[model samples]
Target chain A: MFPSGHPERSAVERNGVEGSRDQTLKVPQRYSSTPLRSVRNDEKVSRHSSLCGLALGLVLIACAIPSAKAQDFLDHVDEALSFSALNGEVRARVSGTLDLEVYHFSGLSPGLIRTTNDTLFNPRLSLFLDAQLGPSVYLFTQTRVDRGFDPSDRGAQLRLDEYAVRVTPWEDGRFTLQAGQFSTVVGNWVPRHLSWENPFVNAPLPYENVTAIGDKSAPYYSFLGIGTPAEKYEHNPIIWGPSYATGVSVAGKIGQFDYAGEIKNASLSSRPESWPITRMDFANPTVSGRVGFRPNEMWTFGFSASEGAYLRPEAMSTLPFGRDPGDYHERLFGQDIGFAWHHWQLWAEFFEARFEVPGFTDADTFAYYLEAKYKFTPQFFGAVRWNQQFFGDVTNSYGGTAPWGRDLWRADLAVGYRFTAHTQLKLQYSFQHEKDGGNDSDHIFAAQFTVRF
Target chain B: MRCLVFCLCLLSALTRSAPAQGSVEGQVDLPRTKSAPVMTKRYEIVTTGGVLGTNPPLAVVYLEGSFPTSSNLPTKQVAQKDLAFVPALLPVQVGTKVEFPNLEKDTYHNIFSYSPAKRFDLGRYRPDEKPVPSQIFDVAGLVTLRCDIHEHMRGLILVLATPHFVVTDDSGHFRLKGLPAGHYTLKAWIDSRTTREHPIDLKSGSTLQVDFPATP
Candidate 1:
């Protein structure tokens, strides 16, 4: 009963914005579009994003006065680019990176992407503003204007992915308080999730895989198989991208241990629009935290856990008469490890996620990814990531139970070259297939050119 | 014995040392840093266009003159420790071998340079490794060094053609000695992209003093 092109692939409908997460080692996010079948409110972010970009550009120009003699310009460009004032007590810098990518994938389906174009182009510009107000207080922010905000979606939009004020009361990052919108505290990949920082173009399976658990609708568990009914697959993801939900976090190090905890407005699976407090309040805030131990310079180990309401108020009407939206929750626990030795760097994360859905059995998924990158030279590097997801058993109406979502795996290979310290070009290839082996058209190839200022 | 003597004669061209006379001494007023230097971030646009140091040790002073090239120059050492390149600026005569030893326990350091004058890759290795790696700078130009594993780690190698050169001291004081009578250009370097040069005539057994204005 499947369509020829697997337009019913049922993956990544709203995941376009999922790729736009934050980009400073200071932090990260996931960006993607909403449902292909629905209208997007993000178009407004696109229309007004130009104004936002102009305003920011004006600030940069006002701060930097490089319009002088070539020698004078070169001599004081960096000084102008990163301005200092108040007798050097206050400093501010404006930096940005741009990515222009082209994608050629075997899978072409209306449900996953609505673009009828032959070659899919995704262009994104990430602007970062960092200010040091004082020795103890600092601010970091990133904004972007991109088509769909997600790589695969069609449309142009602008969004402020991250903004945080950090207060480090002491030295060596012992204890710090950070507030405003920031990357989730539940994982380790966010640090390298940016287009210029990350070795691969696509995020790991856990961040992008769209499970049959939409926050907008009540799930249906009485199913015989995965993807049998296409609509069921449009639900929610175990963890949507960097989950840049609005929150305040405390992250710091004590000896060899690093601890971080946050109270956020939305769950890990909430859509991008719900990330801001204006669209969604923190009535039922999600609390997430992580504890990390750096045994040595080469290795880091971490454990993270998160729990909160995953469903939105829009889903309230679809739930049981007596239950509210917050009645259901999403719980997750994960382990992450990182190793950097010589020219080789490795990172691995394993997570067990559970979503309490209404009118259905709880949806549980086991997801993990192992990625390794090796530098061939100072300017060149290659990387490979192995990602997999396994769904737990769900009680269907039939005599037997099936996995809530399909079990799938993907492998991504990439190589990148930095032409200069500020410019880079990367190429990537990925092969994704399901446990059922239904999606043979999931092979994807993409390339991106990035420039950072 | 005859062949060995012949090889020794050939090696003298590379081992030739400059005479201990004709010194050029000066003080460079380094541009004062406005604030405490931040840790290097890979994506950060280096605001201090200066090549030498993020914290101190102002500039590298070198001379360009007609001098025999040498492949047997003394080797210098740069260590990778605390996730940084020790002695961030290293000025050496062309053809001098520079050794980069990883000194951090558990961590590994892979030092490489993309400079056209001296392009080399010292494969990734840790201190636990048997031997520290080294590379020879055969060309006369600036070579920027970086650690592959750490984006924040940066180093600069100023490879000079002449033996008359000296790195500025912490107070931005430099004294380059042993130059023959000839017309030469005295250059002061901060980073690969930034440098100042002054043409001068050096007389045998004479001392010349010059100062570079503070330029950070």
Candidate 2:
């Protein structure tokens, strides 16, 4: 049901010349420049854990809501009973990986960086429940617990990643209603979780938070709506409907080609006096869509684009320094042209953003990356990626090395081996060069293993 | 009464041709209820006569070391009466003649095959006292017998391979006759459930007993 075979117009199969507006991977951050240590605290983890417990408990209570015991007993005595059955099943999985990073510098000999750091392994646990309540209804639930490993932190923690409930009133499966915290249907790449759906072992750099957006960061696949109400609309009854497309979504079909649109609330500004304070409002709704073709069982191709504003806490926070504390309300635009053929895949996306803060005659920044990957076999593959980023002067006035100034070019090569379907080990090396000066280049060697059950 | 008498004579003549292996004994096993939400109290058994006669009432059902796959039925004419197909259950050999006589004055009837195993729509027929030349079912399987024009008229034509077979009566018991001494496999296939199979060694005159479990 994702996309019917439109082989010729798949997401990856496109002949149109790339336009200026078509930009790629941009990681939107919740708070740019804000220290990561500040946001990741013990309190937040504990609070989230409690909330997960309550939500799961509530779902359990909701399941025990109906019964007709007296009628069943009487029917048994009278030999007039009619009944169905209820059955449940559960499955679990666990996997891990290791990654080491080395570096390659441009205009210099290729060598390993002296400050080589490594990520030993990361494990994830997931529980899925499939239940058939009666003749007509069924329920599916998945819970994930993850342990992230960093050389600095020896301890690990689990998080309730997602909770969803899907209801089917009709057995033929024409209609369904789903509620809970789930993935938003945005760009094909944004919504697909790295561990769950992607063929590549590591996510693209632009798909990360540090580069794409100033503040709020969402990994290529993260979205949650706390009781937000949304419904889908379609002119043709059978072709389109909103069941899971909410908070952020992608939907619609053109001829044999299928397109999905995503919408999410972005940060906006109030009065000039409230400069540093970031308010969660409908500054702009990030709207994006992907149109793709799937001709047969083997291939898929798609083109995607989105325009909106993202929230950057550090930029929005009022700092005492004379420097403009930047703002989370950054106008952003993006376009991604991608296609995957059979087991082998390739894609490239570019992103550009502009800011209209007070002192800077408005600043514009651009970033783009080209990523290509091939799956040599089901268990092994390799990837190569290149990224280019540019930044504008802070003020229009004669610039004396304006507020911030520098551009960066980065490239990475990686090879991964999947020890099992749920576990993979990847080794990647990254090289970066500063167009200006100051710690301009960094050689990062990384090894990571991801597991899910 | 005269017609009934003639049918009985035909049944006697047919049963006589085959060696009659008398009485049989068996039981229908119902699974342990355990903690099932609903307890079934009453059950009903529907039987059909073999190629020769009406499924006999209270027939002695025995367990041959193995289950007998075939049940025989006569090809004789079964007329329409009071808007119902007479002798609703007809068990016949894989190749046998079945006569359908039109006895209704006001209604026409058509015996058709809608079952996947055997498919054929025997066109409609006018009311006539004379019987039409029989339909020979070459395939061995259950054929759901129905009427093309009448929605309520329904019946069954069970085409079988072996001649040794019988349908249980109201008490859920059945029997087969004249099974020679040998090792055989007895299997029972029920709708909406898995089939049961048991190895059975049948003897010249001995009766074997077996039970089949029914789930609620």
Find the candidate with the highest DockQ and give its number: 1
Give lDDT tens digits, candidate 1, residues B150-175.
65466778888788788888888988
TM-score for chain B of each model, two decimals: 0.77, 0.62
| Runs in model 2 lying further than 4 Å from the true structure | A1-123, A126-157, A163-184, A196-201, A209-213, A216-250, A266-286, A291-309, A312-328, A396-405, A419-423, A450-452, B1-216
The candidate 2 chain A region of ten consecutive residues with least summed lDDT is: A230-239
Most TM-score-accurate candidate: 1
True contacts kept of each: 0.16, 0.00
iRMSD for every model: 7.6, 22.7
True contacts kept of 1: 0.16
What's the distance in Å from true for residue B133, model 1? 5.2
Judge the docking of candidate 1 as incorrect, acceptable, medium or high: incorrect
